[model samples]
Target chain A: MIKNFIVLLFLFGLGMIFSALLLGYTPDSELNLTGRYYAEHTAQDLGAANIVTAIIVTYRGLDTLGEVTVLFLTAAIVGMLLSTGAGKGKSLQRKLSQSGELLTTGSHLLVPLILLLGAYVFINGHLTPGGGFQGGAIIASAILLILLTDPLYRFSHQLISIVESISGLIFLALGVLGIFFAGGFLDNRILPVGELGSLFSAGAIPIIYSLVGLKVGAEFSSMLVNFSETEDS
Target chain B: MVTIAMLTGFILILMGLYGALTNHNILRMIVSFSVANTGVNIVLVAVGYIHGRTAPILNEAVPAAEAAARIIDPVPQALVLTAIVIGLGITTLMLAYAYKLYEMKGSLDISKFSELKW
Candidate 1:
């Protein structure tokens, strides 16, 4: 009872602080300096229709790269921590109950469509609301669906690693190329910023985003595979 | 609108914190933490909302020239996106650690693990 009281007291204090913040807050009628600058320059400077995408993929590209690196580290750590048991490379002998017919059939029909939508989302990151991270997550959901349908199914670790490595390498290489040809590292001006809304517009934004999507998707799939493959250790 | 979203986010944060503090099970704690993480992300996106602006996307509806005046802040949206992804990574890490703990102790109770305590 005393512990509950203490917790409630703490929460009450926190709530007070939050309410204070809420009471003092007012929605801005005009864009602030940074927001104004991004809004004004994102299109003319980067040729990306989505200002958020431009900011993430180009203006703050290095930060996004760091974020991806953090995700890579997380995946690597999870794999290392989980894979160090007696169930490393052994074939699956444990029997899993069959998933329902509805799920099996639904996954078969949806997996291809999901994969296509993921690809389309990342490819159109510069022109749409979706981007590399979201698309990559969608792709991972497809892998998850397959795993759910067939728990014993195995994905090629080699293929996933290769896709991850190549895309990461190409993403870094393009950033370096920006230094040589454009204003700075990861600048999207290496290729001509084509027609603003065209498929090939936004210079290298679409390519970089696509690579990011592939790398992220591969990383997430690898993690899911590792998690599913864990045996009763 | 912004006030409402911000209020909801705050309430969620408080509720999550209460759950996390009171929960004894490791899985419940993890779930509470995730709820708090979502609340934080919501608050961030709310902070960027302008009174009468569209999203920070330039299109036929929102021409580039008037973007500065028309769009809400994009920085917070981008930051929230990063936060959500990082939050997922952290949640996955926590689950993996929890699994390892379960394997070691065969229990999911928070009070059972005392090696690092004290």
Candidate 2:
């Protein structure tokens, strides 16, 4: 107990030191507004009401593409690690029978709603706080729920891989198109800039977000399935 | 005030760090890491907070310049959203690995599992 207390104290001290050095420190000038300028100009240029959306889908879209690729690669790695041939030992099979009926039924009922919500979040990401990553995680959670409730419900690996690959290809193609037409990679002005705050506005952001949402959802669901199957094998 | 919130967030992070460092169980460590990550995200969002502000949007009621003037920083919110996604991905991966390790070793204890060591 004494040792634990000492360790806690030491950690507390370290945390305080770090927080003091980092958190409490303010910027050198309050008038410095690089992000503000970018926010204002990019909003008009990209026809997006949300500057962050403009940044994610237009300015730093290459980074977002890379992020989606990372998720895809992660899913693939997890899949490879967990996959085993058929006729594995029975010791790996999950005991789904032990779980309650209510849990299973509730998850079954909630899956569609969760999926809809995820799609909505991605679709309206340009106008809201949520985006592709958030939506994808929500969709992935639905798959996770199904996995927990019904262990025998196997994922169609071929379909998932195809979805992932197709979305990734489309995303890359869109980026290339932006370069060819808009004079830069992932530029949003390729499409006509409709009125601000309109659904048709924010050229390429909503579309990119949708693609990202699909890719992330499929990848994460594949990861979950892969992980669960490894245990079953 | 934002400062107080920041302080509280830091304290939570400290607690999470302690839990992660001292815990013997792999699940506990992962949960603690998540807690710490959440605390950091909270601090980031808090840093973007304005004393008196509204969401960043322009409409018939609110003019564009007025909206921009009163709006709280959207950059941090965007950043936090991305962080949350990445965090979810990493946490899921960790949980998956933990599950795999449990299957192979039949134990959740970290100290006993040392198959890959140089």
Q: Which structure among the candidates has the greatest lDDT?
A: 1
Tell me which residue pairs clash in candidate 1. none
CAPRI verdict (incorrect, acceptable, medium, high) for model 1: high
**Whole-model lDDT per candidate:** 0.93, 0.76
How far is A193's C-alpha from truth in model 2 (Å)?
1.5
Residue runs of model 1 more than 4 Å from their true location after superposition:
A89-91, A231-233
Cα lDDT of model 1 by residue, A1-233, tens digit: 99999999999999999999999998889889999999888888889999999999999999999999999999999989988874655648777779999999999999999999999999999999999999999999999999999987989989999999999999999999999999999999999998777889999999999999999999899999988988552
Prediction 2 global C-alpha lDDT: 0.76
For model 2 the local lDDT of residue B83 reads: 82
Q: Per-residue CA lDDT of candidate 2, range A1-233, in tens?
A: 88689878998788869677566556332212855665457556777776677767777787787777777777876766566443454534645455687987898799999999999988887877667887888999899999888776778889988988888898888888888888688877777878788887877778888888888889988987776665543
* TM-score of model 2 vs. true structure: 0.87
CA RMSD for every model? 1.1, 3.1
True contacts kept of each: 0.85, 0.27
User: lDDT tens digits, residues B3-117, model 2?
Assistant: 7767777877887889988888999999999998998898887777776666655455445555556567767776786787678778877887787788778899988887774
